[model samples]
Target: MQSSYNFWLVGISFVVATLASYTALDLTGRIYLLASARLRHAWRLGGAAALGVGIWSMHFIAMLAFSLPIPLGYDFATTAYSLGLAIGASYLALHVATHEALTAPRLLAGGTLMGVGIAAMHYTGMAAMQMTPGIDYRPSWFAVSLVIAIGASTAALWLAHTLSNDDARNVLRKRLIAALVMGVAISGMHYAGMAAADFPVGALCGAAKGVNAEWLATSVILFTFAILIVTLMLSRFDARTTFLVGAVSNLNGQIVRLATLDTLTGLPNRATLTERIERAIHSSRRQRSLFAILFMDLDGFKTINDSLGHSVGDEVLSAFAQRLLLCVRSSDTVARLGGDEFVVLSENLGSREDAGALAQGVLDRMRSGMWTDSQPLQVMPSIGIALYPYDGDTVEILLKNADAAMYEAKRAGRSTYRFFERSMSEAATRTLQIQNALHDALAAGHFTLHFQPKFHGNGNSLAGAEALIRLHHPQLGTLTPLEFIPIAERSGQIVQIGYWVVRETCRQIRRWIEQGLPSMKVAVNLSPRQLLQPNLVATMLQIVTDAGVQCEQIMFEITETVAMHDAPRTIEMIREFQASGFEIAIDDFGTGYSSLAYLQRFRVKQLKIDRFFTNGLDEHGAEGSAIVSAIIALAHSLEMDVVAEGVETESQLDMLRSMMCDEMQGFLLGKPLSADDFSEMLRGRMLTT
Candidate 1:
C-alpha cells in the first residue's frame, strides 16, 4: 500500500514538474526580455527563487490533491531537510552564476540550466516524500493547484521585471537587492504551500514546518561552507575593482585641476581669465550696469628682480597680491595678467567715484605692503582705470585704455593712478596716425634737427647749443619736439628718435668744431622711457664711441623726477654713464623732489632749475633770493655748476649772476632756434663780443 501511494505521488510530480519547467522557461525569458538592461544583472537571484519555489510548491500541491497515503506522524524533519537543501543549493547556483560574465550565450545557457534544475529538484523532492497512513492534508483539484503555484511564481517574476524596467529600480541600491527580496518572497510562498500540504494539526498552525535536529544540523554545515566560498570570491573582486576605480577618479580630478589653475600663484590662469571676461561683458550688457576695468603694474619691479634674486621677488609679489585682495570690494575680480602685471574688473558701480575709490583703495593697500625682507618697500601702483560705456563698450577698448593710462601714470610719476584722459585717448589716435605717417616720413627724409644756444654768463660766448628735435609736416609746416616727442614715445619709435638725436647732435657739434668755433658741450635731453631700457647705458656708450665725439663734449640730461623716482637704480645708471666719461646733468630739478641732495647722490655736472622757480622769483622776493642762494650753494658744495632756466628779464639774469649761477637758459639769451640761426649766433657772437 505504501509503495502504491509513492507511485501516485511520483506520477503527479512528473506532470507538475513538466508544468514547473515550462513555467520557468516562459517566465525567465519574459524577465530577460522585459527587465532593464541595468537590472539584468539581478536575474540570478530572481531566477533561482522562482525555480526553487515553483518546484517545491508544484510537488507539494500535487501530493495534496492526490489523496495519497502520506505520513500520519509529523514528517517535519523530512520536509524541512528537503526545503533547506533546495533553497541552499538554488541560492548557491544563482550567486555563483551571477559572478560570471553574462554574455548573450551565457544568459541563454544559464536560463536553460535554471529550467532543468527546477525540474530535477521538483521530481527528486517528490521521490523523497514518504507515504504513510492517516495523513489528513490533501491536494485540491489539479487545475486549481497548478494555477496557485505557477500563477504566483509567474506574478512575482513579472513584478520584479516591472520594477527593474521602471524608475522603481532606481530606489534600491542594486538590482541584486530587489532580486533578493523577490527571491525570499517566492521561497516563503513555496514553503507555506509545503506546510499547508501535509503538516500535522499543531505544525500547520506554526509559522513554518519545525526544523528537526537532523535537518538543522545538515543546513548549518552546508550553508557555512557555501558562505565561506562566496565571501572569499566577493572580497577579491571588491579589492581590485574598488582600487582601480578610486585611482582613476583621483587621477581625473588632478588633471582637471591642472588644466584650470595657474601653477605659480594657484589662481585661475589665462584660459579662465578669457572665459570669465567674456561672461562678465555679457552679464554687464544684460544687467545694464557700469563696470570699470583697471590695469595695474608694479613700478620699478624689474630693478628689484634684477638686483635681488627671483625668490625674494616672488615673495614680494605674493605679498602684494594678498594686499590687493583686501583693498577691493568682494564683487570685484582681480587677476594676474602675468609677471608683475595684474588687472581688476570692478562691476556694479553706482558712480565714477565708486570705481575711482576702489582703484585708489587698491593702490593705497599695495603701497602699504612690506615688500622687501630688509625694509618696507614703497611700490606705487600705477593704475589706469576706464569706465564701461564711457571709456569703451568693449573689453578690448577698456583694457587698452587702461593700459595706456597706466603707462601715462608711469610717465607722470611712479606710485600714482590716472583716469583715461581724452587727450591721452586722442594721443593714442595721433600716435597711430603718426606711426602711419612716420613710415613715410622716414622714407621721405622729413625729419630735421634744430639747435638752441646756451651762452656762458660772464663771457657771453657760445658755451654750447642744445640740439632740438623737429619734424617738418608737408601741410602743417614745421613741428616742434613737443608735437612729436609724445607720439614717438607711445609708438616705441623713441629708440629710433633717440638714435637720431645723438647722431644729429654729434654731427652739428663736429661741424662747429671743424669751423674753428669754440669747443663747447652740447646738451641733449634723454627721455626717461629711453633711460629705463636695459641696455640704455650700453647703447649710449656705443653712440658716443661711434660719433667720434669726446664723452665730455656731449652732455646727457635726464629729468630730476625720473632719477629720484627710482633713486638706487638711476644712481647705478648714472654711475655707469659717469664711468664712461660723460657729463650728467639733472634737468628740471626744482619740479621734482628736493634736488638739494641731487648733487651729492648724483655725479651731476650741471643743475637746470625749472622755469617755475625762476618765474616766481620776483613774487617770492627774499624767499626766492634765499632759495636761489641755497641752490647755488648746494650745487657748489658738491663741485657742480647750476643753470637758471626761464630767465626772461635783465633782473632775472642779474639775480642769477649775483648768485654766481654759472649759466642761464631762457628767452633772455634766446629762444630755441633753427640750426642755421643757432650757427649764425655762434659765429656772430664770437666776432662781436
Candidate 2:
C-alpha cells in the first residue's frame, strides 16, 4: 500500500513552527538590548531556554497533527532525549551569536551547528513513534531536507545580526520584517524535514501511551502564544522606561549648566567662582600650599560700550573670555563677574612668580587687541593679585584685598598689576575717613579758595592767577589740596568740591572787580570726575551767572591725563565751554601720555609746563630745559599760550623767559593768598599799573 499524508496536519505544523521561530527571535533581540553584562548574560540563557521550549512544543504539536494508518505511541525516554537535544542546540546557537562578532564565517559555523542539532532532534523524535511497520526516509529527500535546514539556519542568523546592529530611524520596521522572514524560513525548514519522512501502512501497536493528539495540539499552541505575548510586552515596557530615564538625566545636566555658567561667555559665573575659591582655600590649608587670585578689570571697556553699542561690546567680552581661558592652566578657574570684570583662581601654585607670569601673559594678550566683525578693539587689563595665607586666609578677605589692590593698580596708572599690601588697607581706612569728613566739610563751609598770581614773562605785570582750594578742619588744623584732593576724586566727592571751587572763584573775581581792581582771568582746576558730569557746562555757567561775573573772567583748567582719558567727550565739552566765552587750559601738560597730535586737537587757551620740568631747569645742563623749550614752542605753534609753573629762582625765570614763555606762576612771584589778601594785592597792582 502507498503512504498517505494529511495536508491539514502539515498546515498546522507550519503555523506552530512559525510561532516558535518568532518567540526565539523576539527574546534574543531583547537580550541584545540589555545594558548590564551580567543581566544580558542571564537573559541570554533564559532566551535560549524559552526558545528550546518553543521548539520542543512545535515538534510535539507537529507530531500530534500527523495522521497515520497505524495507532502510534511515544517512548517517554526517547521523547525526553529529543527535547533535551533541542534545548542544547538553542543554547549553543544563542551563545555563539551573542559572544562573537557577527562575521559571515562565524555566522555560517553557528548555523551549521544549529542545523545539525535540530536535524538530530527531529529524527530522534521520529524514532520514538512506535508502530508495527517502521518508518523510513528517501535518501535524496533526506539530503534535500538537511540542505534546507542549513540554508534556513544561515538566513535566520544573518537576519538577527542585521537587526541587532541596525540603529537607523526605522529600526522597528526593520526588526519586524526580519522577524517575519526568520519565522517563515524556520517553518519552511521544519516542513521540509517532515516531507523527507515516509511511513508504510501496518497493524496498530503501542509501546508507551501518550496524550491524545487533539488535546496536546490545543494545549501547546495556546501556551506557546501566551508566553510569547507576555515576553514582547515586557520587552517594550523596559525599552520605554530606559528612554525616559535617559532623557531626564540629560535635562538635569542642562539645567545645571545654565545655572552655573555665564550665558554670553560660557565661563563660570560669580556664584560658581565663589564656590571654587572656597574649596581651593580649604584644599590649600591642608596641603600647606599657596595659590593666587587675580582680579581683572578691563580698561576702557565702558568707552567701547558707549561708542560701539552693546552688541559689539558683548562680542568683545566673549573674545576676551576665550583669550583669558588660554592664559591659564586647565586646573585653574577663570570666571566672569559681570561687565568686563573677570577673576582667575589658580590653585597649588609654587610661588608668586607663577602668578606674576600668568598675569603678564594675560596683559600681553589683551594689549594685542581683539577683533570683531566691524573693527578691531584694543583693551588693557589692570590685574590685582592676592596670595593665600599672605593676603588672606578666607574667601571674603582675599577677594576684598584683591579688589583693593586692583583699584590701586588703576590709580597708579592702568594696564598694570599690583599685589595686595598691608599699607593699602591703612590707606583705604584713611580714605574712608576723608570721604566721611569731606561731606561734613562741604556742609560746614570750611573750604576756601586761595589765589596764586601769574606774571607776564615779558614784563612782571600780573596777568592771571590760579584759584587753589584749602580746607580748615576744626580738629585736623589745615589740610592742603594734595592731602584731600585724591580722596575727593576717588570717593566721587570731586564733583561737589569742584562746584564749590568754581562758585568761590567767580565770587572772588566779582569782589576784585568791586574793589576797582583791573579784571584778570582766574584759573580753576577741574577733576576728571567733574569733567565727566553730564551737567558740567550748565553747572559752571549757572555758577558764573549767579556770581555776577563774565564767563571770560574764569578759566577752567584740565590736566592732559583727564582730557586724553575720553578724548571725544572732552573735546566736545571743551568746545561747549569755548562757545560760552570761557577759557580752556591744558594743565600739567608734559606729565601725561597725550601725544602732540591730540594736544593740537583740543580747543585750549594755555598749556602749563608741569613743575617737574620747571624744578629740573635749576640743575646743571638740565635735560628739562630742552623739554621745556620744545613744549613752549609746541604750544605757540598750536596757537596756545605757555605757562611755566613752580619757578622758584631767577635762574629758572631767566631760562623760561629765554624760551619766550608767555607766563610764569610760582612762589617766586607770590604765595597763594587768601581772598582778602588777593584783593588787597590786586588793588595795589592796579594802582601801580
Candidate 3:
C-alpha cells in the first residue's frame, strides 16, 4: 500500500517531532545538571536506556509518516540493538572527553559521535520507505548512509566547537542562552528530517534541489548556527556558577564547625550542650524514656590551676574529658560546661539504678590518675544526679536540683556522689532567712554587751570586768555565747558581730567612768580566726578611734590558741597595741598548749588561769591546793599576773586567794548580767561593801 500525505499531516508531524526532540534534550541536560539524588544515581544505568529509547522512538515516529525512495521493512529488534550500541558508544566518548581538558576540540569529538548516532537513525528511517504503489521496504546503500552520517557529525562538531569555549562556559546567564539555542537546533533538525523523509517524487530529494527540502534544511542550519553562537557565549558561566555554589557550601560547613565545638578539648561546648539537652528532653518525653542529668565537678581543680598554671590545667581537663567520654555509652551525651565542670545527659535509662550505675562508672574512670609532667593529677569527680520525672520534669528544675545535690556531695566531702534530697531545699530556705535576719539584727540594736567582774586577791578591789557578748532571743529569755557563736562563725557575720562588741564595750566603759563606778580595765575576747586577719590591726585602730575612748581603757583578750599562731605577727601586734596604750591578756590559758616561750615572745599583761585548774583546786584538801599553787608559781615566774576563772564558790575563791592568784571571776561574782542588772550590782557593791 502507498502512503499518502497532506499539508496538515506535515505540519502536525513537524510539530510532534520538534516537541519530542526538545523534551529529549531538556531531560538529557537536566539528568547531568540538576537531577534529584535518586535520579542522579539511576542515571548510571537508566541514562543509557533513556538515550537509546529516545533515538528509537524518534526514528520509528519519523518513518511512520514517510514515503522513501528506498523502502525498508521495519526491523524492530535490529533497530533497537543498533540504537543501543550507538548510544553506548556515544556515552563512552563523552566519558573519555570529560577526563581530558574540557576544551572546544574535546567537545567537538564527543558531540560529533552523539550527532552521528542520532542523524543516522533519523536518515535511515527516512530512506527505508516505499515511493510507488508496487514498491516494498528496502535497505539504503551503506556507503551513502555512511557519507551522510560523516557530514552530519562534522557539522554538529563545528556547532559544538562554538558552544564549548572557555568564555562561553563562565557566565550562568549566557549558558542558559546556550541551552535555549541547542533546544531550538534539535527541534529544527526534527522538522528538517521529517521533510527529507517525504520529498515530492518529481522534486530533487536533496534540500539543495527542492524548495520544501531546501527551505527546511536551511532553517535547520540557521537554528543550529544560532544555538552554537548562544552556547559558545555561556558555557563557562554555568561551570563558574556550579563552582561558586560548592565553595559556599564548604564555607558554611567550616562556620558550623567553629560555632559548635570547643577548641580546647574538642568536645561539644556549652552552646551545643543547651541545644543537645533540649533535643534529648523532647525525644525522651516522646519515647517515654528516663534521662539522667549528671553534673561533674573536678575536686581540687583550683589547686591544680593555681599551682601549675592554667595551660597545664587546660591540658589536664582535656585529657580528663576524653577519659570521661570513654566511660559512657554512645547513646549518652557528654559536654564541658566551662573550666573543670562537665555535664552528661544519659537517656534510655531503664531505672534510677541504671543511671546510678552509669554515674558510678564515670566516677571510677575520673578517679584514675592523670599522669602529667609536673605531677600525677589524682582527680576525683563530685557527681550530682537528678533523675527525670522524680527530681524534675523540666530542664531548669533538673539543673537546679543537680546543682543542689552537687553541693551536698561537696559538703559530704569531695570525690563522692549525692542524689538530690528534699530536705536540702528546706535547709537552704531557712539558712537564707537567718542570714537576712542577722543583717537586720545588726541594724536594729538587738545585741548587747555584759560584764563579769574580777576581784583583786589582795584588797578584793575590782581589777577589771571580762566583757561578754550576749544576745536576747525573743523565745528564750537571754541566750549566752553557746547559742549564736557557731552561726556567726559560719556566715562570716562574726566580723560585724565583733565590731558591735567593741563599740558596745567602749560605750559601757564610758558609762562606768561617768557613774564613778571605777576607771578599771575591761577585757573583750577575740576569736582566733578573726585575729589572724592581715587587716586586724587596721580594723582595731578604726574601731578604737571611732569609739573615742582610750585603747588602754579597753584591754584586748586573746585565747591561748590565738596567741600561739604566727608568733612574730602576734608579737608585733601586741607591741603596736601596747604603744597605743592597750593591755593584752591571754585567756583560757591551761586549756590550750601553753608555753612559757609564747609568754616570752608576747608581752602579755596577764594570764587567765583556766576554770579547770580553779575548780580542782579545792577537790582534794591537799592535792587541789598543790595544783593551784604550782600554776600561780609558774605565772609569777613568767612575770605575768594571774586571773583565776570559774570562781563559783567561796572555797574556790579562798583556794585561789591562798595560791596568790592576782584576781578572780565567775558566777559567784554574779552570772553574766544585763547592762541594767550589772549597773545595779556595781552600785550596791561600791555603796555597801
Which structure among the candidates has the greatest lDDT?
Answer: 2
lDDT tens per residue, model 3, 465-487: 88788766454345567656655
Flag regions of model 2 displaced more than 4 Å.
Answer: 1-26, 72-77, 100-105, 131-133, 165-167, 201-209, 248-273, 297-326, 335-341, 364-382, 407-416, 422-689
lDDT (Cα, 0-100) at 27 in candidate 3: 30
Q: Each prediction's TM-score against the native?
A: 0.56, 0.59, 0.46
Lowest lDDT block of 10, candidate 1: 199-208
Q: What is the lDDT of residue 464 in candidate 3?
A: 74
**TM-score winner, 2 or 3:** 2
Angstrom error of the Cα, residue 450, model 3: value is 1.6
> Which candidate number would show the highest TM-score if scored against the true structure?
2
Provide the lDDT at 163 for model 3.
37
The models' CA-based lDDT, in order, is 0.64, 0.80, 0.65
Model 1 TM-score? 0.56
Q: Which regions in candidate 3 have their CA more than 4 angstroms from the true location?
A: 1-433, 457-460, 473-479, 532-535, 545-548, 590-596, 609-633, 647-658
Can you give the lDDT of residue 404 in candidate 3? Answer: 72
**Candidate 1 residues 444-522, lDDT tens each?**
8788877777777675656776777878878656767777777677556777778778887887778878888777688
In order of TM-score, best first, we have 2, 1, 3
| Residue-level error in angstroms, candidate 1, position 278 | 3.0
